[model samples]
Target: MSDAVQSVTIVEVGPRDGFQSVGPFIPTPHKIALIGRLHAAGLRRMETTSFVSPSALPQMADAAEIVAATDRLAGLDAQVLVPTARHAERAFAAGATHLSAVLSVSERHNMGNVRRTPMESVADYAQMVAMMPAGAAMRLNLATAFDCPHVGRIGADAVLALLDPLVAATADVEIALCDTTGRADPAQVRALFAAARDRFPEVRGWAFHGHDTYGLGAANVLAAWDVGIRVFDASVAGLGGCPFAPGATGNVATEDLVWMFDHMGVASGIDLDRLVDAARAVAELPGAQIGGRVRDALAARARKAAA
Candidate 1:
């Protein structure tokens, strides 16, 4: 690998994607503390919360508080996920400067997720760009871009068709292709990303969000990385699941991704030991469904060494 391709940025999504999946409500103070710990462990960018209906996602009811708390932390880019134009408005109003606007690529997933089609979501994206304040940044998260639980494999054409309008509208945008069901193979990931880069050379950057339901999270990430994607979304302790997509599991774990990169000589600037500590704390949360191999393996290794 060349000097340019030897590093990456891992955007922490545990505070939003991971926390929202838990049945029990984690206190706002606890959420704040975890985010602080994550930042201290060298995570500069994070998906802190989502601005949505409290009835729909009770866990994100404290979005404003989380944003305010993270704002106090210098050098931290706290990104909030907004599902609609209205939600984007609310997020910007709450002092969130970085917004992650999400909409699935699959028609079935889009309808089930936000009650709109892909084209309607594109319209909302335009509104989001218009309302975005000066100097603010936005990332377009194209969920279910690879494979959808409702409709099976989503072709590269379907993903590029949606991106054509969104990318044309703005010169400043980062795109993330999500493996919503964790069923995408490495070949599919490489093909879609390569095609996207070829089609839209003007896009600022590209990211990949993958889940580990079928144990291909690391493999898929490597595939995207090979194709020049530098940013990635990962949840701490592997805690996540799509509320709208049935049978989908948690996201790729932060520890697992970090370990993979560290061994491969790829710089992520994250402290793996401290990240494991944060993940262990998250795992202790009541009713939290955590998944990841590195945390448990490290703990076991420590025990064996002590014995």
Candidate 2:
């Protein structure tokens, strides 16, 4: 409702999160092209790839190559999801200046996801944060912070507890509270974000990553935006989900989120037509599942206007 809410930041995660969900591997060139197109579409922060084991996530096997190829692109801040200190070092080795370290708030999900307890992962992440050089950027993505498939309803207090280890370590960090399976409600979203802001004033900014498993991804984004959250993680055409979590879908579609903000007169700084074109291209890639309403509706509207 205010002028400050008029502008926003969109973090393109299709190349990493979406592509990783696909069964077949997307070629490095396809990954690079999509990221390039996303950048041209006005996304500054993009998760290009992950430094996890290729055996585990074959889709991101080209992580090193992607960073090698795209790190120098003008105006694009390339980042990678690092699973450990070694992964973080490797990501930095591949010319990535921005790094994301994930820690799920749900102990059940954390054990299922990374085979570590929440505290164990926190200890590991502390080392990972220490390992990074001062100039390197970081974002702590708290997966299943809202709710987990294995354990439902992670309260705001538990989320703030997970933030304690990293909060004491640095003042230059950002947070991405993820609804890994898209079960997050708007009320809980507003509460958790507000709690995070109050508990960790050291956090530089906040972002939300939500899946559409429950069809609340877009609504959750708006909820977060209402509380002054400007950055978001999205996959073009709703292209991804957790490979480990059954029935999970993609993050809120980048195209749909852009359309939501644009209609509300908010400047997300994203090129809608170009983003839709990129989504269509991503849909053509091997093993991609496309389910974004905006892209399809835009196509229909174009035909209607032409008629």
Candidate 3:
């Protein structure tokens, strides 16, 4: 808190989160282009793709090729979601520097997501970390941390309890508390963040990822930032949704969140104009749509300027 933030790191998840939602296979070229566009936009941290089963998510079938394309970019912390040891090895081989180990805080949700218990998933990740290449980063994304469709309103104790085992098992791992269904309100977000900071003082990284289902994603993100947490995960133009959760909506839009920080003079190290263009380009993908208002506004502004 001593030095002012000239820029912030908004982890671009559109390539992974946004592309994975659609059912059909998106061409490798387009996926590579989207990643290239985001990396070129000065977005330092980005989730390039997921190394899940092709049968499950055909959209991410070309994950390795995407990683092979983007990981070599300069100053880029390209990440890939690795759910198992198999995926971890593949991700590492494909040239992923950052690995995201995804799990849900809600028991039923975790079961539905990866078909494993929360603690079981944690144990799996511990082994994966040991085998990971030297200096490769690992981030654990705890989805459904706030509320779950299966079990509404997860209490703070339950969240802490789920994390306790994971924290004990893993050393030097980053934790990302997620509003998977976008059901979290600002009050609960601040309270949980405050408690996590208090209990896990030694935690090296504490990040947040929220959804816009209840129209509170940006508010919750700002609330988290107010409490001294900096890292965020967003989809370009808000082009993401949880396919597993019914009615689960888009992740907080990259352009809109950047707009908020820009107006507030809080630098996120992301270029707004270029980010809007990236969002627009991703929205053009088959079955993809732009959900962020800022990107649309940017288009209109571009049109008026040309006029």
Among all candidates shown, the one with the greatest TM-score: 1
| Descending-lDDT candidate ranking | 1, 2, 3
- Give a tens-digit lDDT track for model 2, residues 196-251: 89877768988899887768889999899888898999999998865545665667
Stretches of model 3 off by over 4 angstroms after superposition: 1-6, 242-249, 302-307
lDDT of each: 0.91, 0.85, 0.83
Candidate 2 ranges with C-alpha deviation above 4 Å:
242-248
- Candidate 2's C-alpha lDDT? 0.85
- Which pairs clash in model 2? none
Ranking by TM-score: 1, 2, 3
Please give, for residues 146-213, the per-residue lDDT of candidate 1 as tens digits.
Answer: 98888898988889999989997785888999998888999999999999999999989899989888
Better of 2 and 3 by TM-score: 2
